[model samples]
Target: MQDNGPSLVCAPPAADARSGIVLGEDALTVADAARFAREPGDVPIAIGEDAALRMDASVAARDRLILMRRPIYGVTTGFGDSARFHLSPEKTTELQRNLIKYHLNGTGPSAPVDVVRAAMLVRANCLARGYSGIRRGVVELIVDCLRHGITPVIPERGSVGASGDLVPLCYLADLLMGSGTARVDGEPVPAAVALRSRGLDPVAFEAKEGLALINGTSFMSGFGVLAVHDAEGLCAVADLGTALAAEALMGNRSHFEPVIHRQKPHPGQVRSAARVRALVRGSDLCLDTPQVLEANPDVDGLGVIPLGRPIQDRYSVRCAPHVNGVLADTLDWVRRWLDIEINSTNDNPLFDFATGRVHNGGNFYGGHVGQAMDSLKLAVASVGDLLDRQLAMLVDTKFNHGLPPNLVRRVDPGDPAAGLHHGFKGMQIAASALAAEALKLTNPATAFSRSTEAHNQDKVSMGTIAARDARSVVELVTEIAAIHLLAGCQAADLRGAHLLGLGTRTGYEVIRDHVPFVDHDRRLDEDLGVVVGLIRSGALVAALRPHWDADV
Candidate 1:
């Protein structure tokens, strides 16, 4: 069956040949995952010298345990409910094979190719930590799969976020053994065909290799990494969208003053204010509130003093820093946690070569990932609601400070009224609908944990579900931001975009390049697609990058 998830467009890894990442040595950052997702490539991935030695030592320990007939979990014994049923040494290899085959029951759609690739990278990183007692060949096989773009078609469901995403990860282990399906350059084919065409053969598993490969937090980590990276980009996009809307609304720039932010002393608020201030810097359209200009007579007659603007813009416009600042702060917290998670070994029964012992622990639990994702979804949904409000304000003349109703550009100036043209009328509705859906998904996924596996797998972390929800919220917000971006650009043009701030001007021009000013009532569906592509393609984010840096 064909896998229908979005195909990842391969981009080069952020690190070059000299600075490339080495498995089990260099740390993997969320940004690295983002770069790898965009451009999947064959970067150098080898077991580190020290890690390899440790791996050898670990394998020796496992062998000794097997010789002594030690009752090891998933090694010399059955799994889960059958843990008491011991396996003979001769049947260990067959037990490992059966472990993977029985868990090949993942339901639901396949994850996106980028997610699968990220999962592969994360899983390989964990194994390369020299704790899983796996052979170097197993690590090399995973690397080759990623290097060749052979993304296993793992289902989106069947993980309870405990015992480390076992069901979905089984598909990955199955693919390495050439028994499942994989996507070769986005085309689905039999895993055996994909592997053989690349001059590779299916791997034969040893006693504990299959369990080590299929157990751990790779799936959740992959989704969480992508969500965090996308959230970072979305926060920047929020700043850009709001900056343009501020220019269009002729909003008071005094609200973002450093002194006011200093009084509050929130790092995120300060950064957010500074970012917006930098974006609107050098713009003639940005006005000070009468109270602000009046209070400061030093520069009273300095700028193009606009008259009849409100004493204070609405909360959506004036309180943008507070909202987007919360987003910035949330990202800071999430990144801090993910940095540790993406690098740490999250498997069970970690073999300590130095101690010559196997340690069983709950490192496989995904509660940390779950908590981060749950909080992240709320932040993402809040931004979605913020953008939804901004989009609404841009479409209504009452709130838009004299921009045309629904932001309809006037073509025939003599027509006096362009009653037939209703611009962004339905677009605003779409934005609201998306925002509502995102908000509805904000219910904590961790609260719905279910017990399974004969009560052995009780209190499973629903971190995977939370991560998926965060990803969905990010996607929805990206759409809403696209609508607001298009409308903000149109409003900027109608209001004489020359008055826009430096960064806002660049953003406006970029939007105008792809989606022209909507002068008449026309279907904005295609325009939305163009703008969404620009946002998702990172053009909008890149355009706004300098402003944030300058502020910093």
Candidate 2:
């Protein structure tokens, strides 16, 4: 079959718009990223796109070096700890091939299929820039792999976040050389068979092609892309959850009053507060009187004095915007960093062969991505923690004001427990466990580094770990938010209140549509799965987009 065209992968707009350096466009909004998942053949790869000219210039300089007698490090000699070794013209090819083979030492479980695909796509794009002294044929081969779904089985471990994502990328290089393993039609096959099945030969590594392939932060960038994409979803979910919690608690909507956010003037805080206000708009529960005062007519309840339940709610309910606001700020910072990384030429020995200067530098270091991922993970964890606390409040009779214990089906018709039983006991436990895992993963991986390879890689970025952790935290937060959604929907259903914020009511209805109220306890995993699927599929995000867009 002819190679399919560029797929509509949904990467963020900022990350996808630029070119040259790999990683442009937000990973979340990139349409058809799976099209670039391996390497496509028909897609036109260029070096001098309007957005990537600087990188193109850098690569052109390297090509100029091959015409000169100057001994560029990887172009003419050797690489890495092997930079001192010079290769003869006949042996240069062998040197390049060996470089890829030696680096294919990654271990541990295979990375997610999407991440592996993204890594291959990024590597090919970097090569297409032409700065790496790689043959255009090599770039085409990589693209062809993407088009054909020939994803190399890259291991998740072994990258120290320095000298690029060498270890995992080595596996990718090996597959291209017909020496490693690849997934053909979703089945693991020998590299040689996989290449042969596509009627292709092993890619012959040229001068710096191996180094170029293995010597970038594609592993970290892949995770960064995936995490940032998912984080956007988590942020939206957080907004939805906060709205639900606010309505359920019957807290002051004045806290989200636009004027309150305007005074603070922080963009994220302002956005978050505004989102909360929008979600709770038209909420009858938000306007409902406290049950304690509503139930008692004569006990110190003068007709002149309006009866109210508790004077105040717990901090989790009252201070939701303050908690989720931090996450909004963190997401902004991550988005900025990801945008820069995606558009940056983060390769080593940056080929300025044009200036007769091959500057072997630490441009490939993933410290920026590392710190950003760590910060994002922590922020996400905090959101998860907040959601967990909110869910707890919903289920606990002592905390819910008048709601049933566990938000369950009550036993007696007239009794507070009549129709409700513990609706979310198992879900609450699961949410708490997910939150705890998220919290444990929040320790900044950037700070926990061990100098490896005889201290040559003394300062490690641990950026891949950070990105993976952030992705994990995003998943955990999504689950927590789903639990909150379930609880909030149940509460709203039990109360029979008509008014709900436009966005929040939509979220509640979406949840109700997927997993009906737990009138009787059945299989909880099935319900949880439905929620997870909805969140991952961006159902909730789609539901709330109009309200958020209008408010913004």
Candidate 3:
């Protein structure tokens, strides 16, 4: 049913917070889902008219198959290894209810509210495609919960990414029946109470309704969407950090020159280099090749006049585009794959009205998300390592040109407290620790697939674990990027913020406003956290946006 999905990924407009977000057989962008997930007040959900028609027709097909009393997977027969067992039509509803009850085995921490909300939206979108055969009213109940801001407390763990993230999805299904816990405005409450207070009633499971709700890739896809979104932002922030570091080190700007990237011309590399160049457009501190050569020109015909400093910067400063380029390029394809996975009807026993057949298959497998997230985390961690190295160079005396050692805030040479203060040294150590942790998680989660469900599902996707790991890496790298930015801003201050490049000056001022210069040793843990907030909220990148194109 998937025809290479959408070939393009132009981000759709942000979902209107006041107006309802429309869920149908259409594309839902990362920006839109993120908006709906975190918008403070309740945002309504609307089922598209065509999607409603499709849902109606699909339910009709399910009823038609039941009339003949034929055996259909999860409809008349038992689930998993018990499929050999048969059931009467009267008992199918009971079987479905039992399905939800048995799989309430999810354990560990509750998923973040954003992940939960995004999962709910993605699941509703899948059903809106009209192949799952769920009752239209049941689907409406799910939408109403979203509209009323009642999100199920799904565990972040316990999903193997096969058989439709069974454990976590079971919790979501149970919520529909008003039997689980939900969060209202960030406070936990009984699902029954939340629904009742919002004027919604508990839904009873019908023949296929429970199975339809609990079977799909919603959990993994939700995390993937957010991870991809954050990874993109991290890449841009990394470039800004590079620009700031270049200015602080008085490094050569020739590395990001258009002609250098033009030779290779990988889209990501080209764009990444462009962003750095644009950020440092009119800077005097970062010297061009000719400027450095002119300053150290040979005075006599004797070869070898000491240039004092190296002609080029280290790899972390010079090869940043190649590193961040991989992430930017990986996102292009990952977005395409997620476009297909989220929009697909991935539940089992799909009802196809055109051929008058109820097809039972393995559409619920989440291999695509698993692989995409694994690849994404690997790239993000690499960028984190790159940013860490950049931060390392920004503070060290051997590498930071003539900047103060450890970027100490210009204490007089012989002052009693001059040698006692250490600035950003602790931040560099913290960044290294975070970078190591992020790298450790890059090992593929999909490679550790387990055999379960009585071996009825012998091979599994493990996509959910991978998506979660990717989210972890993105988060850790965000902290690393924060430290990198703080150090970059500190280094820029040492060199005089006014001398920073056009775009980097804007980034410098934004960071400096929140965190002033450290005249002496002080607790900077709070400063790290504040910059982390700036990075995640896109505030740092947004400040630089006026100087560069929005796409950067």
Candidate 4:
């Protein structure tokens, strides 16, 4: 649970990797953000040579719009409501600088370092395609910041998820220009000092470079990608946790039989049922025969009596697969959107200078990412709600079969408070509080919108809020799962040394490693924290992957 081993390292990238994209299948399992903050390799940033040549030829064919008289949206005019303001060629560079400086209004707590790094990576990748018309030097600055661990202090709020996450990204652009602030080697410093310390000069804005830098959905998309990736892990853990819960409860495995799954055959439901069956396969308690006795013939006739608590367990234990299976299905939907978002070109007013054409488009709207992230948060919260219910069942005497109340300590009747002690009262309370917070955070932020900046952003997508909410939900879900694991392990121990399935055994081993059984209810919050840490570090996933694969 509390692994004191060395931290997981970042393994080398595979040979067939592309520039700026860290492929997940072959990449090292990054357990912490510090691993990603280290300098990356020399991935080149190149202009689209083929597209540039075509654009050059197209520019040659157009003499009607001469260089001195030509006008471009961001190139020769102010942005948004000020688009009517035209500028001479001499003022274009100054205009770009002014654009970045004026829009730096992002406020709130800074995002986690990894998210900042991810945003940098997303922005760099978008620029690498060479459609934004920015010089290669500008893109390289973003790459350098990421490589050298000089992440700009980007606030978490103030993004409309349209018009390219303007306010939030301006904070990043401003730092690159040596005019804002950034975190250098985990210490806050002036942007100018941070850049200078790295022997890098702040980049000056060019014709369309400022607009290109700030006019994109990198903020929302980057956070969404991170949230969705973490949600996938949570979904997997939810399945594993549900299976372990079923095993601890000695619930009917018939519900997960192949025949039962074949009749309906929803993919998530079938997969969840199969996983539960595998985890309960070698469980001796699950296979134990029910005790039966014939009633006495003395009074009234005779009746057969069934024993061993009851024939069926409570719904929390019996219905876990169905509850967690829905989350698995929701994750599948979120993954599709994330895949498309990561590969999308979301900059607005795309240019084809070679063909002498420009297309203003809806690429700036973040509806896709916003909706996906909103759904992901709700799904993860639902998992937390399910886990909370299961944990309650594990601790409540009514549902715990013959186990001790709250799994507490028992002693001789003569000694009331001597050897007798209470059990997971504090832990159950913590679980309830955490579940309440998770439910409170379930209100989808994407559905709330307000016009701002003189109604220029009349219809907004609060994708940033959705992402932040999802992150909070992830923490709450991890805490709830920790409580469930602690309680389930206790329940299993109380039921005697019955052989458990591979997955449940691994989970028990994880708990035994750090927090021992609750002989007495000492401080439980500390133990819960340890379990939460283990879950967050992917220790559970690594331990259970072998068992999961063997079953399939």
Candidate lDDT values, in order: 0.83, 0.72, 0.86, 0.69
TM-score pick, better of 1 and 3: 3
* Candidate 3: residue 334 lDDT (0-100): 91
Q: Per-residue lDDT tens digits of candidate 4, residues 386-462?
A: 88887776677787656677777555569767545768767878888888898888898888987876777688888
* Per-residue C-alpha lDDT of model 2 across residues 90-172, encoded as one tens digit per residue: 56668778888777777788888778876776666555443455565666677667667788898888887888788888888
lDDT of 1: 0.83
The local lDDT score (0 to 100) that residue 9 gets in candidate 4 is 20
- The residue ranges of model 2 lying beyond 4 angstroms of the native Cα positions read 1-71, 75-78, 288-307, 413-421
- TM-score leader: 3
lDDT of 3 by residue, 156-218 (tens): 888888897889999899999999898887789999998998999999988888889888999
lDDT of 1 by residue, 1-552 (tens): 011112311222334455766666436677776677667774555555655565677788788888888888889889877888887888888998999999989888889998888888888877876778888788889888888889899999989888889999999999989998999999999999999999987888997899898778889988998998888888888888888888888788888889999998778889888888889998888776665455444535677555454667788878888988888899898988887776667777777766678888777788889999999999889988998998898889778878888888765666865477888898999999999999999999999999999988888998888888898999999899999998888888888989899989988888888888887777888999998888777888798878779666
For all predicted structures, in order, the TM-scores are 0.92, 0.86, 0.95, 0.86
Count clashing residue pairs per candidate: 3, 49, 0, 1
**Model 4, CA-based lDDT:** 0.69
| RMSD value for candidate 1 | 6.7
The candidate, 3 or 4, that scores higher on TM-score is: 3
